[model samples]
Target chain A: MKVSRVASVFAAALAAGLIFLPLWWVFASSLRPGNSFVENLTPLSWRAFLPVGGSFANYEVLLDGDFARALLNSFLVAGVTVVLGLAVAVLAAYALAVLNFPGRGYVFVFVILVSMVPFDAIAIPLSGLFSTWRLSDSYAGLILPALANGFAIFVLRQFFLGVPQELLDAAEVDGLGRFGTLLRIVLPLSKPALIGAGLMLFLSQWQAYLWPLLIGTSPGKQLAPIALANLSNLYSVDLGQILAGSFVLSAVPMVLLLFFQRQYTESLSTSGMRG
Target chain B: MPTMSPRRWRDARLAVLLLAPAVLGMVAMRVVPAVSAFAESFNHLSLRTGVKEFVGFENYAYLLGSGEFHAVLGTTLLFNLVLNPVIVVLSTALALLLAQRLPAVGLWRSLIFVPAAVPGSVTALIWSTAMQPDGLLNALFAAIGLPKQPFLTSSGQALGSIGLMLAWGAIGYWMLFVVAGLKDIPQAVYEAALIDGAGWWRRLTAITLPLLRRPMAFVLVAGTVGSFLAFAPVQILTKGGPDGSTNLLMYDVYANAYQVGDLGVAQAEVVLLMILMAVVVAIQFRVLREERS
Candidate 1:
């Protein structure tokens, strides 16, 4: 029994290490000074484990070039998408959860149907239509199509449903309007849900590849992923720079994941039907 | 006016008022685009002419009869088939182990899950760095006295490499759901099984596995849709690769829309993918729902 317990512990630790090794490799490589390809490879060495002669030269190389604009574009795109997605989701969620009205079922079903249409399906026509309207290569084109997410609305509504009726009633008795009750009473309580939804939406947009690739074809306007890819192609010699930019691109979501992992997992647990 | 008339009317008005922005956003962005995409599938999209002209079923027919389309469809299915079972089984096992009373489980689980927090685009970048011809993977091979393998450069190995990266990121995600599912199971059931002289394997098969069907089904269905829509990894790593060996359906769709500048065929393929997703989602939901009711 003791041996088996030790074996299970060893196995678990091994699995966790194997899973996290690639990320560690990226982090370690990104921190190492440039032009150390041979030294970066050797296994079972401190050079492979820790940064030797570490510096921010790789990050400077990335940010001083095309990556600077692309990074800014990523922030703009993700920020707008989150703010817009949450704005619409909160109102729609409140309506669905707090109000009594006809055709709400139809509206909810429409949200599901919206998500059922695949990204590729929508990207084809949307790119054309936006180009026709002279909206291509702009933030509007990049962010508009993604602002309406059914999963966000669904999660927030589910969370809103859990707010006690007594609180809402008390707010109403205190002469709070429907909007006031929602803002003062309900919204504050749904912080975890809101944060989870925002983080997911923001992270997805920050990493958005296809939309920016297809629409923002102009130079210096691509998002981080597209830009990083283009940078690697343009400067394929610098592996360190590539790894550094990827690490930087992942910074925001990593922080959010570390801080809000519980809420993030909570959303996934309840929102199974989402894409 | 009576209190009922005023209050009911106000609530109804408020509902409509509140729902308007979200509904409008959905219609303009999601609803209208989808409906127009279906309409556009039968038309030719040409930037040179600046006007899309109706071309009947030509787009669908061309795609249906094309050899490239068939190859992409086959690759898509191959990816799903290879990825889904591995993901489900491994993640389930991980979840089962994590659910056990182990030391430092929280830190271990977090480390396993941190990979998921890395965006798909960055994840692709990281994997590409690792899989390059003279990359770390080959270095490890040479150290172990084995010949270097062409990971992303070889046609046959490209798709498998991408799948490996995806599975690396996905196992922890599916594990989260599985852990949640396991939490809902009663401890007494497991205790009773143990008291009846049942071993770990028997308790798992009888009590744990049966109870896990719903969350497992949830993971499978969502995972299938996600794997089908996987685009970033293929784009960043191989770009449909050394000899088009890694050209999955999503890449083909992007190539049609952006590379070839043919939205008609892209929309046509998108329609096909959506139908596939709908069927997969519907069947999974129905199976789980039936089991419950």
Candidate 2:
């Protein structure tokens, strides 16, 4: 029994190392000075692990370029989308979950069916509409279409369904109006679901490449992912600069994930399970 | 009873207040575009003429008749059929292995998940770099006394390489879901199996597999849907190159819309792709429901 326990411990350690060591190497290499990637390719020297020749020149160069503007654009798009998506999703979800209305099941089914529509298929028609409305290459163009996310509505509705109906009824009996109850009671109670869904939406928007790339063709309006992708010069290939930009572009979502890791994971799992 | 009239008025106002934003947004964004797309699919539109002519089923007929469209559909179907099952099995296995009471489990989880945080474009760039002739992967192969493989350069290998990179990036995220599912299983089941002299494999097959049907179903559907719609990696890495081996339906739609500026053809392809996705999702749900019954 003790031997088996020891074996399990060893196995766990091995698994953890398999995943972590490579990541550590990448992070360390990203922080290392020029030519270190080439230098550390072999011999496995101890000097490679140290910060003796490390510098933030890569980051400095990246931040000085279009990276800052792209970062801001990412924030603006994701931030606005989250606020708008949550407001709309919460309202729709609350209505469908709690209210006894005509065509409620049909609405639920429609939302789920729409959720399966791949964004790739829809992007062309969406772009055409944007062109007609003269909203192309604008922030409103990006945020407006994404605000009608079916996944958010579906997840939020499921959560609202699980909220005890007795609490809602009690609120109604206490002279609380529906909107007031939703604002004060239901919204407060559904914090976990809201945050989870919000995180997922924000992450999706932040890492959004295709739609943003398609719509935001202009330099100032492009998001981080798109900018990082187009950061190459006309002639020279700056590996260090590219790596630095990639790391910076990746940092936003990573930080968000770490902060809301629990909520994000739970929400994703719940969404999958429900689907 | 005296206040019923006022209460009814207030309820009407409240309902409108709650439903207005979402309904308006849905109409403007989803409903409007969807209707316009359906309308546009039946019409001829082009940048050259800037004219719209009604052509019922003409766009669809053209798309169906195109050899490229047929190839794209076949590629998408083949990619999904192969990629989805491979990812499901691998992700499930990884999840089961990691879900055991393991030391540094959090570290392992973070490592596996960090790649997911990387932008899709960046992932494509990294893989493209790694697939180069003198790249890290080739170096490792040479060190291990193996011949170098032209992973992305070869027509036959390009699609498979893109598929592998996608699976690598996605497996961790899916594993996280399966891990969540595995956690929900009670420990007592395993404990009971231990008392019955059941080995690990037996316990897994009898208890774990049966209990994980819902999550498995979830993975299957999600994987199929996601793979069917894959586009970015192909765009960044291969660009559907090496004689169009990597041209899936989504990329084909992209080329039709952007490259060729054929909105009608693009819309036609979009409609077809949606139908395919709907069919897959419907079949999956039916299978899951039937199994439950």
- Of the candidates shown, which would achieve the greatest DockQ relative to the real structure? 1
- Candidate 2 structure quality by residue, lDDT tens digits, B144-164: 778888998999899998887
Maximum-lDDT candidate: 1
TM-scores, all models, native as reference: 0.94, 0.90
TM-score of chain B of each: 0.93, 0.93
TM-score of 2: 0.90
Per-residue C-alpha lDDT of model 1 across residues B115-156, encoded as one tens digit per residue: 877778778888888877667777778778888788888898
Off by over 4 Å in 2: A1-26, A32-36, A42-52, A162-176, A232-235, B1-9, B286-293
C-alpha positional error of residue B267 in candidate 2 after TM-score superposition, expressed in Å: 1.3
Query: What's the CA error at residue A161 for candidate 2, in Å?
Result: 3.9
Lowest-scoring 10 consecutive residues by lDDT in candidate 1 chain B? B1-10
